[model samples]
Target: MDHYSFFDRDLSWLLFNERILMEAEKETLPVLERVNFLSIFSSNLDEFYRVRIPVLLAVHKLAKRGSSEKEDVLLEAQALIGYQQQKFGKIFTGQLIPLLKQHKVNLLFNEPIPNNIADKVMDYFYSQVMSFLQPIDLADTKKSFFPENNRLYFFISLRTANDLERNVILAIPSNQLPRFYSVSVADEQYILFLDDIIRHNLNKLFKNEVVTGCYSFKITRDAELDLKDEYHGDLSEQIEKQLLKRDMGIATRFLHQPGIPLRTLHFITDKFGLQSSSVVEGGIYHNLKDLMSLPVNNPLLRYTRWAPINSYHVTDEGSLFDHIEKQDYIFHAPYQSYNTILRFFNEAATDASVDEISVTLYRVASDSRIVNALISAANNGKKVRVMVELKARFDEANNIKWAKKMKAAGVDIIYSDKALKVHAKIALVKRQVNGRDKYSGLLATGNFNESTAAFYTDHIMMTANPLLLREMELLFMFLAKGKKSAEGYPVDFKHLLVAQFNLQSRFMELIDQEIANAKQGLPAAITIKLNNLEERKLIGKLYEASQAGVKINMIVRSICCLIPGVKGMSEHINIRRIVDRYLEHGRIFVFENNGDQKVFMGSADWMNRNIYRRIEVCFPVYDEKIKAEVMQLISLQLQDNVQAVNLDTALQNIRIEPKPPLIQAQRGIYEFLKAKSDN
Candidate 1:
């Protein structure tokens, strides 16, 4: 672990965000999709300030302020962020606006409102926006003032009687109103931001005063919640309290309009406790994450939608249980349907012989059919148990809400222990078939939420294997009653790799097997696809395999610390990342053991938290057909050059020189599955 170099984790994440920005800058992509990329980039940067900046600030503050590694990181991040912001502005103002205008879609920014549309804009403003406006005096002596997180406000300069000037903060009505105001004028269409409409009506608000200048600004606050050590008190209660405290946490970044007067900026900064961090000068529009909601409804200007591919494995519309019982079935999401799993739960809920249901809910959709099916199962006199992980960040409130509803519906709700987050995705259905208890189980690399299944490429395994189901039953029991009710919960996992006990060791042993195979002059190769790869010891093991001449291909989507292609350390290691129509979210580890390959997929990423902190599960792919499907999917991804980028040691995305008959992996997989279905 010590001999080699590693990329800084936060910086690596910044590079990933930069790749998203690069997507926005790609001329080949559709303009509207590029705008969506811009929104994703903007939101990503906001989170960087919200979450990562706080940690960096804490490190910088406790050390020598002038010269620290954290300070250098902040400076570097600012530079990179500044560059990206400038690019975003150029793309927005210079390129996208003109292109949309060419298509007769007018998105007017900093342009004079033509005579035809001014009246409608004012009428809409008076009716809809005027009531939402709340202008506050910056010089109020009654109370102290500070900006809230991520909301847009205007720092305005106004002139009153006797030539006296006043500074005010105009809270833009974007919260209660749409960010864009679209209207058609005869043959021309106009779209305006809510900021400018208010800007146009500034004189109306200031009756006796002269409107001077108006500029936009927003604040990004530190959003990382601190959970106390487990032995303190009730974990859920503590989490609720911490969520409230998050609003009052330290402000990390102050983003302001570029042309604001020095006096106004100073007045605003001094009134609030925003003197510590550097202020970033930005455009009149602050939260451009709203760009995701661009109101153009033309299909010609957007990416063509593709219908989700069907599961060829489930050939007929027979019982899902029958299909899985015939052989193990693996479902690839987005490219394949999620309804089969939904049917599994619905059938379990409605089937007359079904007796019990168990599931782990990490993050469910707001209108989750899964939870509804579970509630129905409980109402039908079936034993239903749900392990809701309330510590899922940004999702705690929703999970808590669902948990209360499920608890009220006569379902058994077991909250996750504060010491370990149950991040594994698994569901068990116990049924009495012919008076003998039979088990059907589901395991996946993603959440059970159907919303993300439309865009996140994840793997789900439907298995009727008795051994795996028995182990899963033990896991549920252990989760419900930790350490006390189970005899060998932590020590003895052979088929499934659980995080607290066997995940890291099993992966290490697998890597060692590959290394031994290579040393013995046999075929040794590995392909791993994961969201992140940062655990130092496992990375070190990969490095060892590299030195032993075992070829490794890693498709890491984000925050990869391993420096691949380094001589004498990781020469045999190569890493590429695919950022495309679908998020590469599934975790797969394929090892070539001389000729017979071994495939395993699961929820656990090769990160410290996933390995040592959370309760995760990685299960082996035993069925030959399902194993081949998983391998085929991985092989398609490896052949992909249209969306794949080779991640070099400098962390730059060097485009892979695509082979002939260029393969876009997601499309190829869809076609492959479709052909299989046809056959």
Candidate 2:
């Protein structure tokens, strides 16, 4: 076998973020949409600092006695981020702001407030923002203050009555108030940052002191929860306690606006014990993810909305279960309405025949109609079992809230072992049809979240396949035991590929089959779409198949470690990345078994966390029509030139130039599904 190289995961993630920046740079897109891409880029970077940078820093420290490989990767990551930040600044200031101005909307980006709107800005601040402001005098050691993670604050330099210098920290109330304040003067609209609003009114709070300088800053902390593997206590309570400390975790990045005095910076760093943090000089405004709330609603300055097409028709007389039992159905989300899936749960909740309901809730929506329906099912005398994953990062609180509500409503709630997270998006319902147990199931590529379903492109399959649903019920049964490992589980899972048991091995076997056929002088190919691609073993297997003359194509939205188009290793592999109005989130796998092709779609990405640590379900497309639909969707994504970019050997996103009849996969999928619906 040939030796292969992989891109550093952190650097590869940065490359993905850069693709987002590229979308922000497109002049043809609506200015606000471009601003949204910038917001997404900023938000993604903050997550990297909170999650990945700490891991990198720890690895760098551990490598003190080893090679400098870890240190080099860390430095390269920093350099790449710095370059991207500079590019972000140029795009925001040089391109987007001007475009907004052309549309009679003025966005104040690091600029002083105009004199015309001074009265309106201060009036709004005095009435709405003053109550949320909390200032701590850093000079007074008796008063204790800890800067919360990712919350914006400002360092103030002041001269008091005694002519002595004092330092104070004031928390920006962006959490309490809108980040951008909008006011209309005549026919033009002007948007002001809440940062500027507070900056303009500092003297009012400090009546006896002279404000010298003020700069904004925020701290990014490690987001990992410290869940013990063998804890006998309530996991929900344990996670809730950990979540309170999440904002106070050890700081990983101390991002501050430039031009702070050196002594002030050091004093603040020492006071907060941020000595080991990555101190970075950022823009005048911190947390530009707030740009998503620009407070301007101009339909003409945004992408014309595509109404979600009703793909699955559920009549008043017929329940969703009636359609599923007759034939298999698939719905592409955002392009197709999520109401069909919602109605699946809604019907199960009310149907007198439904005897039991089971599901895995990883990330539940805050106002989850699905959870409400589950609660309703429990009240309707149906057996409800929910494996609520309390370990879903950043969503621990919301999931816990819904779990408690469901438990209160007499629903049987199951929690996964601390070490294993059930990332599967699946639901099972058992009904008594003709006094016999019949089942209908839903397996999807994304969360069962109605909120995310509106903006995230995902695929959901509603089926009555007995073999598949029986295996799903067995998996749920295994989860009920709260076992840390799947080693002793009796389920074989021949039809469904589940992580921790058969998902990885089955995928490897599929790749091996492709390699075998390629070596036999037969046409062999593989296509996969995932949010991330990082497991080295699977990547190596893909390389081995490529060496055997199997063609591999992948659409990885972010974090690809496998270096494609490499000589003697992965010469036949091609990777595409698509970023557009909707997040490309569905995970699809296709393999050519000589002449017969097999397709699987589910929640599992090839990331190590998904394969080795979590319980994920990827089910086969057994129906010929649904199989053709899945194949056609992947084909469109592979042919996309407008919103898709190819990953080169160096892992850079290379734009696919416009050929004749250029295709944007998301739009094309919508149109394709629309025509089908019309027919």
Candidate 3:
């Protein structure tokens, strides 16, 4: 183990983001799509600051005086990020902006407002933007203003009549107003940043003073909610209280535009108590995630929309339950219609036979139709029990809001303990048929949120498998107890690999089986796809299997700590990462038992939190047809040369160069599903 090495998780994550930035550099993609990739990269970096940077800061602080490893990692992360930010700016200005100009669209990136649109910009600023502006005099110590996390602000330096200097902070109300303003002048489109609009209008606000400098900046704070295991209050209420305080957490990154005087920068830093933060000098504009909302709506500048195919078409006469009861079905999201999933809940809500409904809601949509269906089921006199994870990061408020609504509608709401979260995306529907209980269920690899389903590539299986549903039912019953641990409930989960009980052990056993087979001179292999792979124990097992001559291929979308393709350790293992139009989010695990293959898919990533803390369900694929389809999809992704890149041991995303007939997995999956639907 001492000889073996693993990539640092944060550095690996930065490499994943670099993959996204690489997408923006592709000359073949649509310009708007490239802009979108840029937006995603920026947004992902903001989240890293809000989440991971705080941990790194804590690690750096706690390291002993003689130890430099922690500090070195922190500095390396900062340097890599600085390099990526420079590359981001170049791609935006050098490539994307010029491409937009060729299409007769001018996106004003760090440029002055042209004379043609000056009047309109002024009029719009005066009428709309001025109302949201709140300027704080930084000189006034009594006022004490705290900047919210990730909210844009302008640090204004002013000189008065007596040459007395005054510094002020003006909040850019991007939350209250649009981040960009678009105006058309004589058949040409011009897009303006709201920051620039307010910059141009600084004189209108400060009449008697000379505005010396205005630089845009934002503070990204740690987003971890403080939850005590022994907390006695209602978990949802406690989470709501913490959500308000989340933005006020310790600042991790202080990003400001360059050219601020050193004296003023120190003064501002001390003033905001950002002494411990990593101060990054950035471009003129902050929060370029607003580039996603650029007012250019040309169809040619975007990826041609592929309408979701109807995978499981339920005839109007027959219900979704009827189809599931006959045979199991799988739906690939964004490529396959999510309506069948909706109809599963919709029919369960109204069906006369359904007597009870159970589900686990992690991160729900704001206006979730599935929650509405659960509320309807409760109102329709069915027993509805929902385990809503109040600890879903950044989505605590929305989940709490829906939980209260469902509880008000007489639905039984169960909240997981503060120490654990229910991350399983599963739903169970029980019906009374001929004096016996019949169960139909949905187990998915992603959240049951329709909004994300439109763009996140995931897999959902609708099944009437009694064994799996029975195990799921037992798990829900255990969840109803709301205990902090899964120890006392002694139900053996044979069909479903549930975290905190059998998930890690069962996966170890599966890998061990492959290792044994490989040792016996039999054919053995493993394939897995996940959003992240960071758990060390399982990674060690994979390494052991690789040493045993078991072939392993993995597609990890982000944060892979396992150093693949190493000599004498993981020489047989290869990892690929795919980043494209849709977010690749489904988790699939396959192991070859000599000639027979076993497949499993669910919400669990091989991360520390998923293995030891969260309640996750990874169920085996029992149906041969569905298993074949899942294998085929994984095969397509493995064959992808266009969007897939091999994640080298050095943490670089090495592009798999195009062969003769290049295959992009997302596009190929859509076409395959479309052809399947056509047949």
Superposed on all Cα atoms, the candidates' RMSDs to the truth, in angstroms, are: 2.1, 1.3, 1.2
Instruction: Report the poorest 10 consecutive residues by lDDT, candidate 3.
Output: 63-72
**Backbone clash count, each prediction separately:** 0, 0, 0
Error of 2 at 63 (Å): 2.3
Q: Compared with the true structure, what per-residue lDDT tens digits does model 3 show for residues 389-454?
A: 888888888898999999999999999887888999999999998898899999999999999999
In model 2, where do residues sit more than 4 Å from their true spots?
67-72, 312-314
Alpha-carbon TM-score of each model against the true structure: 0.96, 0.98, 0.98
TM-score of 3: 0.98
Model 3 bad stretches (over 4 Å) = 67-72
Off by over 4 Å in 1: 63-72, 230-234, 315-318, 482-491
For model 3 the local lDDT of residue 523 reads 92
RMSD of 1: 2.1
What is the lDDT of every predicted structure here?
0.86, 0.92, 0.92
**C-alpha-based local distance difference test score of model 1:** 0.86
For model 2, name the residue pairs that clash. none
Q: What is the lDDT of candidate 2?
A: 0.92
Q: For candidate 2, write residues 92-179 as lDDT tens digits.
A: 9999898899989999877788888989888998899999888898767798999999999999999999999988899998888888
| Residue 598 in candidate 1, Cα distance off native in Å | 1.1
